[model samples]
Target chain A: MKGKIRSMAYAARHDGLHAIRPPLMKRIADASAPYLYSAPALILIVAVMLVPLVLGVSYAFRDIQLLNPFSGAFVGLDHFRALSEDQAFFRALRNTLWWTGASVLLQFTFGLILALLLDKPFSGRAIAQALVFLPWAVPSFLAGLNWAWLFNPVVGPLPHWLYRLGLMSQPANILSDPQLAMWGPIVANIWWGIPFFAITLLAALQAIPRDLYEAASIDGAGPVQRFLSITLPFLAPTIAITILLRTVWISNFADLIIVMTNGGPADRTQIVASYIFTQAFKRLDFGYASAIALVLLALLLAYSLLIVILRQWLLSKD
Target chain B: MRAKSTFLTIAHRLAILAYIAFALFPLFWLLKVAVTPNDLLYTEGVRLWPSRASFEHFDFVLRHSSFPVFFRNSLIVSGSTAVIVTVLSSLSGYALSRFRFRGKYWLVTLMLLTQMFPLVMLVAPIFKILSPMGLTNSLTGLVIVYTAFNVPFATFLMQSFFDGIPKDLEEAAMIDGATQFVAFRQIILPLTLPGIAATLGFVFTAAWSELLFSLMLISGNEQATFPVGLLSFVSKFSVDFGQMMAAGVLALIPACLFFLFIQRYLVQGLTAGAVKG
Candidate 1:
């Protein structure tokens, strides 16, 4: 009877007699047709993203001085060699590393902790979550302004208050201090980063089935034990993806640095982004700036490729 | 089951309260300073509140400054960029999320590639290009540059949202005597209100506070966005803390209002693909 009914349904599907028909061939087409329809977006993305990227790569190799305007001379490794001799380039590179390294690690740490804390059910979690996410909503440039003032020494409220509370030796201009300025952006970044990390990890946390936790508990597993055994393993992939994305973002940041220090205190806070800005706009050294930009791009590209590899590795482990 | 769990729950709540306080302290301080009287600003030092409060600074900034001009310019730039980007990205994102054709993989790869580069790197070339077009020192140029820079990321954002929606609704509408564009407009567009709101808010706030391009492109205060205009408060000798902070406080208003207006969408967007809840 089951076979007879199946055969009749199959016949109806093949004949297209029914108003709604589900079949293997139709399902394949349905899945594929959307991809086919996405052609225009694909084209535009290529035009907008690909062409410029490739153009940038080619431009990086040439001696594209602004003085010449229209035509650029092809100079092979000369630009790279020139960059090696440049002290400001080295400072920027070092600063870029520091920015990416510190910001990415802290962002992950804070995001993870917040996500874990917020994962469990609690009263007022909704409001807490919204408040935590608020910083990410504000523009990054505005965030820099807010933090810059907060770190101000005399007229600024923070140092003034700190001194009043007997929390400091004296009024410290955190922004003007070379040692503190880099961290100024880092602090602002971490503040902005908390929400992104919290949201992503929280999603991963919620995906873990209650049954798994219950079973672990029944087996006499402690909270830490259960989390280590099940939660961490399940969350590894999401964490990896999140970190990769954030790393690329943190490295490419230009606004915060610009607004906060302008790579100042004698270029101590200059990251690759700020460095490029100075070289291109401030110094009018377009060729050298392009080279720096290329190098920055290369570093990020490596990270992007690593993300792909990590994703594949994740799938294989699963 | 009752007493021990209740005790633990209270501890958990306390911990969350601490975190919330930490997160909100800056914004609370912003409001606190905005309300604090100018004479009390330095005199009150680090105190959370002043012995006295007034609306004088807000009044002055509103009634007696170039702030209104900056505010109007910002609104125009941000609004135009958001609307233009959303429209462009809507079409492009639709194509990306719903279609398949030649070079699709490459196209996506290219978009991803664009995102990989530091945008500061492109500023020079962009300036060089825009300079000749006579776009510099103009709000239109700022809007165009922002639109260009924001399009790729916004397209990706819109695409993700489009992907969440089932294509069946549009197909169904098409089958029921609607053209593809009509189906997209009437059926699919309504469903994407949340996504549209997210894109608009994101682009608006982005262009609103953008300083680097505005500074590079516009040389004068006449066309300055608020972020650039804020820098004008600084001079060769000293920074005007009162005026700068007041302007900062005023700048916070539109952004706050913007988010407030679109908070519903932002909330929805945060949870879009996360979990069933």
Candidate 2:
């Protein structure tokens, strides 16, 4: 009788174990399948981006002399000290701010204007749209070079014509003038940036329901009144997002300065990017350059995160 | 009702025509300079067309100088970087768009953060890392650097494209005895041709015109890209406008041909499935 009872208990235990095992195995398989999908991309991104970032941050804190890189000493805030006090770095900071602020505002305005103009039905719309978008399609370095050539004092067609036509007393080397040099890059950047805004805003414009406009028209609203009541409100989110993103990008408009000015006329047009280049490559002071980079990075991070947060809030409200 | 709007329509068309002329004038001048004889470049001054036109500058830039070498180098670098970045970004972007993962948020944030830094900052550490690998002063080095810098934004671009695609088609493919990767290649990639074209165009143009890394990495004329080559036109005292503009015009051809080839897909790609993602 005791042997039979013990055998029954053993059989129950084995059945229970078998029943639990399949679900456990299945759960493991299910959870891991998604992970398997994501693992490759995650690994590549980390290898290319995350590792370098962490290394950059760590290197920023260390006092790394090129001559004695192996003997890096941990000097807290020394690099930061050097950057904040540097006159050239400060000029770059100021210039970058102006570049970002002016470019973002004007680009948005022109983009919206162009998008609105294109929104209406017209002949040759496709070709006109393409022509406008051409600047953005070209790489910015090429555009900068083209603009530099256009503004060349002696040989360039634009200035030469102006000089011969007596529009100016002297050949206006726009780049040579401290006041006008920065404008060359500004124009180049604005040209490249406007199309992105135009495309995004145009996409948003197309989404607005026709019924809204119809109803407004029935209420005796003019075209301008309808645009104010209907178009502006609908475009606000896209405009905001576009501005935020553009600000983030235009801040790094270093390539323009590099190709055009090389921060010329005594660092007058130097922005954070060119300044960082000058510090790192020309000066060979990696630590100090890295510090300025950190500051620039911090500015970008704050704006980007703010945008993200704002977007989330807007979405949640929707 | 239709007649009243006809006058307005004609005026609008005329306005657009004017705008088109304004946009294209610069490109016309690039060609104008390319063909203008060197003697006529300055002597004719502001004249729209020179009395004489020749291919002397073009011939000189192409034959007597390093322009062809620069062009070839640019082609190799831009072509390789575009292909490499597009392939990588497509796969990674697909993963990001479709799969829910443990670290997706942080991974994306980190990629954005990488873009946030002025690339000038990364140039030092990049040089440090690539120096040991002997990647500096080579086409491979430029390709690698361009690929690294471009991937994040390319990934974002491609992810947006992938997101625009319907997931049901892929799911149906999976149900019909296809693996995920196979489905991606056979079904999804065909639909992504426009996206692929846009990505290729963007990356190609970017790497083609990049000057900073080229200026830094390459020291010799043989390895120089076009932008750097254009700089050689500038000696200490005088700038060679004819040769430089001639070179610039030649550079514009590949880029123009590239844009012409991709422009159709680029337009469709930008406006594709707007109401969706």
Candidate 3:
């Protein structure tokens, strides 16, 4: 009887342990499930973006050139040294500020106006919204080409109209003149980018509680007053974030300038992003290009940090 | 007060009209020039309507140019990238939406960081890495690069869609002995078809419009996507405005179609993103 009881107890204990093991294993599996789901994307992003990013940063310090086979030696800070003396790099930097500033400011201003105009209900609003937003759907490259064609005096009417309005001495292509060349791409950038701002702003605009507007109006708030009291405050966060993101994005946008001008007319339109492309593609100097890119990356980070700090300060002040 | 309101209304309509005109005029000119006969192109001198419109340019572009090959290549790259990105992002997005994990915050931050950095920084490095792997100058290379670049935004987009779905449906399926993945597939995935379609369309247009990577990765005419091909065509035949515009119109077709497909969802998607953001 003692042996029998002892054996039964042992069996029960073993079975209990066995039961406990499965849940532990199951717990681990459950814990890892999210990671498993995200693993593929994470791996791809790491391999394709992160690894290349690190390698690119390393290239900033190394002598790496595409066409030159013997250019793999590590030359610390040599590219940066060269970049310090590159006048064109400085010019491109300034132009980037101009391009980004003008593009973002104009896009945001117009986008806000367009969003407000579209906010009210009207007949044919849906079709009007779609039509106005159609430009966003046009591929950026095609937008570039279309605008380039529009600015061409030979086949386009813009130059002739400008001359007729006395905005130009003659119907010469603005793209070919160094003084006016940057505007060609800037105009194209504005035209292509406005819809992006409009779409996002309109979304934010729609999210404002209808009751808020009604309340303001009931309080004898005129349109401008209501807009100031309610709409601006609601739109502020969206505006700040969008502008911050878009400033970085448009500064890096080299497509329009590249397609339209190739950064020519004495390189008047060559922003840093396009300059990086020109260096890598035209010069085959990957190291130098990477260096310029690193500087740009640093500047952008600093700008972002400043914005964050400013935002925190404002919040604290409030 | 009524007179003031009336004037305001008129001004609003006029302003909207002006914006519509500004937005459409460039695209309108593209279409206008595409159909204008070569004989009348310059001679028409910016006439609102051509004296005579012809499909001669389109006919030549379709029959003679290498645009057809570029179009096919672009279709293959973009279609494959869109499918792959949507599938992968759906999984990751689902994880992000449903699961509270240790690294979730960091993952989101990492994805946002990817958006901020200048992609041009990666151009040379990516080229160097791909060239030796025999992936350079191939459509597969373009697909891979484009897929990586687009997945981050698409993931956020898909995550928003997933958030819109109620958890009860999937939970019920799970209680019925279906695994989470199985529930996601069987119950939740079907309901998110609109979101999937929107993501697909968005990624497709993005991949189709990509210029920099395609230009860098693909060299030969056989592998050249539309943007690169169109650019090369421009350089080679700079004087062929009619033909180029016709090709431009051709390129616009798929994008516009995709736009129309996703137009209804665009505002909703942006709103969801903005709210979450």
Candidate 4:
């Protein structure tokens, strides 16, 4: 009887071990599964983006002009030195700031109003929402071209309308006038971009709890007062993040400038991004273009870091 | 209070109308010019509607020009990029949503960093890299580049979608003897079809609009995407305003269709993300 009980206990222990081993193996497989899933995307990103980024940085210090067969020599910051003196480069830097600032400000302001307007329930809200958001669907290149045509004196009505409104002396294309040329792209950028802000801000606005608004109204808060206290605070974080991301995005956005002006009518509308393109494509000077790109990259990185640190400081204070 | 509220309501309606008009006016003008006969295009300056409209420009663009080829190329590239990015992003996004692995934070950071930098920086290097491998001027090259560029955002979007799904559904599947991969593929994926559709639409529109790399990489007219072809046509035949506008309208069709399909989901998806964050 003693021997039989001992054998029975051993047999149970053996069965428990068998059950535990498969699960241990399964856990190991499970733990590594996420990495396995992510590996393909990570590999592609590294191969296509990260490797090229590193190579692009290296190209900044070398001469890698596209057309010139003999131009693959290490130049050691020669492109940078020349960039420091290029008047066009300085002008482009200024234009970039102007373009990004104006575009962001207008898009955000109009977008906020639109978002607030749409936030309220009304008849035909669905159709109104779809129609208003259509521009975001238009391809940026096409938007650029379409707007360019609109501003054209020959084929478009904008110039004619402006002349009628006494906004201009004649129905001349503002795109050709160096003085007001940058506004052409800036306006187009705003028209193409407002829907983005509207969509994002509208989403954020909707997420604001309904009870908060009810409570505020119960406390005798008027529309303006409620907007000032409740709406503003709720929209602040979205506004900050959207503005930050858009600043970086718009500064690099060259499609409108390229399509509208080709950085032309005497380089007046040439932001740094278009300038980089002109160097690489028109001049075939990849080395110089990469150099300009590097500086732009560094400035953007600094800007992003500054925003992050500022946010952290504010958070800590609160 | 009654008077003020009524006034506010009127103001709101008018405001919404104004916004809609501002948005649609440009597109309407594009269509207006596209349908205007060649003879009427210049004569009817500033006319809201032309005296007579014709499809002559559209007919000419479809039969006479290389636009058909360009359209086909764009469809191929954008369609492939959308499908491939959705698949890859679904996997990576699943990893992000479900896993607590090492380097996950860094991976997210890397993806965001890609979005913040000027893509023009990579233009030269990509050309150099791809040219050596004979990938430039090829549709394959464009697809690869666009897929990489779009995956980051699509992944984030997909992750939000995945987060909305319950973990128990997959857990129960696992408990029923299905592998996790099978569960993800057969169970969770079908439930997230709307999210998948949204991702597909977003990536499709992005790839469709990409101009610079396509312009740089494709030197041959044979492989030119819609943007490149339209641009080249504009520059070469600057006098054909009607044809160019017609072609522009054609280009707008697919993107608009995709947009209409996804617009309803846009706010919902973003709200999901905003709430989670």
Candidate 5:
């Protein structure tokens, strides 16, 4: 790679010297080229995303209301104090754990199975693969609404089917049932997210050398044994990184909950992210919303940091 | 042993079939509800296929509602975002792919940080920032935000594409007296067409599916994207299942089309950057 860059750089200067461009000017241009290429994207990200991020962090320290013009005063620690006493916030924190955990676990488990099944070539594999991966293409809010419809007994089928199967006493909407409400969004999330894991793991699975499996079989290793000793070990890195990234992403995902239940039925499905949205949009409490969002952000960062440390430690052990 | 192997093969096929059914059932249901006649919708409950089906809802959603406007706005916003993002990211991605320059580490980190942080945090502040500049409640604002949000991932994707192409091509061009940028434009860009298509598809679907930001930014029906329009419509008229699903099936068109177009490259494109933040 170093030699490649050097040769490219040498060629660049050679061209510069032959042309009207001075070698000094050529060197400066080459040095600034990457920056120029990246400048537009960088400027947009900073202005639109990063600036707002910093402002949001500051909003956590101030009292900012959407409707009130006089509500932008600096109010240090008040929102945090209210947050500490707020039961809804604590419940949301717990619900976030439940939502993210169940969604990721179920999605990964099903996704891994699907990937393994598809790893082998067969008739109609292309069509089947496309069909099975289709759900990931559904817009998330639509997915949530679709699932909500399924659970609703009015014109949908799931509740009726569940009742007929004796899982429920009668056909009823589970989203209105506090004990079962969170399941609505979690199920939607699992359905929507499974293909992500399946696709990634399938790619990783296909990359594994075919000869290794062939060799394992020739050596009299059973399917289960080969999976344990070969497949599992090979997939460890992708699984770890995928799970870590997915955990953060899922925890911050509130679209399903927001769409399906809107954190209703006594707030059973209200994860922290959804709670933040409610504060920001419903109550128009920008300051309080920013405070909650800050906490969620901190929690996600801590979780990511912990995973990084764990990964580093594991690497060191090896 | 032969029987056991045969049984395993059958089991695998069965498992795949089950997955296909599970993945497609809800979308099928969406279509089913959309087509079921309103009278049959309530009278004949829980049937896989209603006794009578109609395109009445589709007709209504298309001809007699605000959906056409929402559809146009979404296409405009998503298409513009996809095109703009693809262009910017190609340039940035090529730089990242070929050049080793100062502050590259920080640039990569900044992009990574944008991906990690909860964008829901930006709701209030982004609203505040855009409102002052009269960018709020406009499709242009949405295009700008979506473009910025997607650039990082698209850049990484484009970088992977550039990485796959041989560096020799560009070097040869430079040796022939073309500057690096010219070589990149004339030689490298044409080779990455599939990559460009994949990036465009990826960004289009993302922008198409964006919910909260558009919901926060666009309040009026005039500028509302499909998600915002459909969501607000669902909330206001919760009882209109047939019409809602019809609108939904309509919204699914561009995304599903893009999905089909890019399915071939999905794994290759994502696997390269999926590991990073």
Candidate 6:
């Protein structure tokens, strides 16, 4: 970063704006190269995404319903007021916590194990790695549908198998049972998401110096001791960053819940993300939806800040 | 110690096999159901393989369903989005990699900020904005939205690739009587062919999987992408497990094919974007 800055100032002094010998046309062309390269992408993002995001934030302070033609009224805090008392929204918030917590925890644990397993130089490990990572390629909606089918009693084997194993009293669709509905999507998410953690953690694991482990072993360190003293410390930054980012990312991920349950069976699967979809699309209440989204955005930012502070604190302790 | 090491090796292999089975089982079920004739779908429901399997479901979906249309629409949308995003991101990513220009910091920050926020927030507003311009309920609209959504991460992915190549290659070309732009085009972009392919495949899969906006923006059956089409078919038809599973398998084909091709570089791509969900 400092090198880039130094070069910028150097170019400015020697060959850029301060130089007098260069022709006007040549200088202009030289200065505008990066702009010309980047303008197309920047303009599209501004027009499509960034502009809409600002508008969406503004929508939180107004009354905007899709079907109601005369509904663009300025209603300050009315949406937020309604959101505070909405039991369903509160329920969705709690569900978001449960969903993000369980999904990240399980995905990380299994992913670390999978990475550790693959780290060894074993025969046919390449094919094994590919096969195990295949689930991450399955689109989120299909993952939901596939798992939802598995939970269905008639066509799927899961319910019957669980029944045979005496885990369930009968073959049933857990998706329609409010108490157990969230697990349906949560399980699908774990299946789809495990590969992500595995791939990334594997990359980090491979980058760890092999000699460090050799040295630790030669120093009479056992497997668990070496893992704690070497692997854990080596992998800590990657683990922290991945965990923090995945938390926010998964909380915003609503496709599995939306496809599987649509927040049904008494809204058991209604996280804030799917709730935003439900409000904006189903109810056509853009205002309320944007308000909920604003709250979610704030929460995610706060969470990210918290993680950054926690990371800094841990680093300072060492 | 030898006996314990031998047991650990067996356990490790068993664990790998177990994970592979768990990963492939759901996909296997999708294929199994797709090939199973409707009559035996329920009778052989819990069986690992259907007693009688046929391509009747795929046949019916291809010959006599709206799926062909959905498949074509998905191809067009995802393909266009991927190509367009690759082109745009390549340019921006090149700038990010090679330049020390003004406002570069802000530009990078803007792109990163876009990656972090909830895109569901933009649904209603984008609809409102696009509808007035008559872009809603159109494939062109879907393509534009998808292209924009993908460009930021694709840019980062492309930038990482550019970063890997030494700047001296382009500089050497520039000093040998070639302009910087010409050198970048003739000498540098060719070397990043693998990165470009990886970016294209990555963006294509992302555009293919998008659901919410497509559902919202494209209201009619004619413009529906695969996700919207398959979803509506599921809700409307309600019980054609054979056909739905067949279509699901078809939807899986393109993404998985591209996935297999680019699986090796996923560490780079995911690290760049921090894993888009």
- Assess the local accuracy of residue A274 in candidate 3 as a C-alpha lDDT between 0 and 100: 96
lDDT of 6 by residue, A249-310 (tens): 89989999999999988988899999999999899999989999999989887776675466
First chain TM-score in every candidate? 0.82, 0.89, 0.90, 0.89, 0.90, 0.89
lDDT of 3: 0.89
> In model 1, what is the error at residue B12, expressed in angstroms?
2.3
Count of clashes, each model: 8, 0, 0, 0, 0, 0
Per-model i-RMS: 4.2, 3.7, 2.3, 2.6, 1.7, 1.3
Give the Cα lDDT of each candidate: 0.74, 0.74, 0.89, 0.90, 0.90, 0.90
Question: Residues A270-305, candidate 4, lDDT per residue (tens digit)?
Answer: 999999999998888999999999999899998867
Cα displacement (angstroms), candidate 2, residue B166, comes to 3.3
For residues A1-318, could you state the per-residue lDDT of candidate 5 as single tens digits?
A: 999999999999888776966777778888999999999999999999999999999999999999999989999999999999999999999998999899999999999999999999999999999999888888888898889999999977899999999999999999999999999999999999999999999998998999999999999998899999999999998898789888888888988888899998999999898898888888989999999999988877877666656655754777
How would the docking of model 1 be graded? Answer: acceptable
Q: Which candidate, 3 or 5, has the higher lDDT?
A: 5
lDDT of 4 by residue, B130-193 (tens): 9989899999999999999988888888998998999999999999999999999999999999
lDDT tens digits by residue: candidate 2, A1-318:
999989999999888878998997777765565556545545655655566566667668887656665746777898888776788888888888888888888888877877887888877788798887666655556677777877786556767766778976788887888877788788777766777777788878988998999999999999899999999999988777667666776787687887788887787889988887877667776677777788888877777778667755865897
In model 6, state the lDDT of residue B67.
94
lDDT at position A211, candidate 4: 97
- Candidate 5 chain A: worst 10 consecutive residues by lDDT? A306-315
The two-chain DockQ for each candidate, comma-separated, is 0.29, 0.36, 0.64, 0.59, 0.64, 0.72
Model 1 misplaced regions, further than 4 Å = A1-78, A160-168, A308-318, B1-7, B235-238, B261-277
Local lDDT at A276 for model 5: 87
True contacts kept of each: 0.34, 0.31, 0.72, 0.76, 0.70, 0.74
1 or 4, greater by lDDT: 4
lDDT tens digits, residues B7-78, model 1?
Answer: 888887777777687677777776676677778887777777778877776777778877788889999999
Q: State which candidate, 1 or 6, has the greater TM-score.
A: 6
After aligning candidate 6 to the native by TM-score, how far in Å is the CA of A69 from where it should be?
A: 1.0
- Work out how many backbone clashes candidate 6 has: 0
Model 5: which residue pairs collide?
none
lDDT (10s digit) by residue, model 3, range A183-287: 999998888878788999998899999999888888899888998889999999879877887898899999899899999889899999999998888788999
Query: Could you estimate the TM-score for every candidate?
Result: 0.85, 0.87, 0.94, 0.93, 0.94, 0.94
The superposed Cα distance between candidate 5 and the true structure at residue B208, in angstroms, equals: 0.5
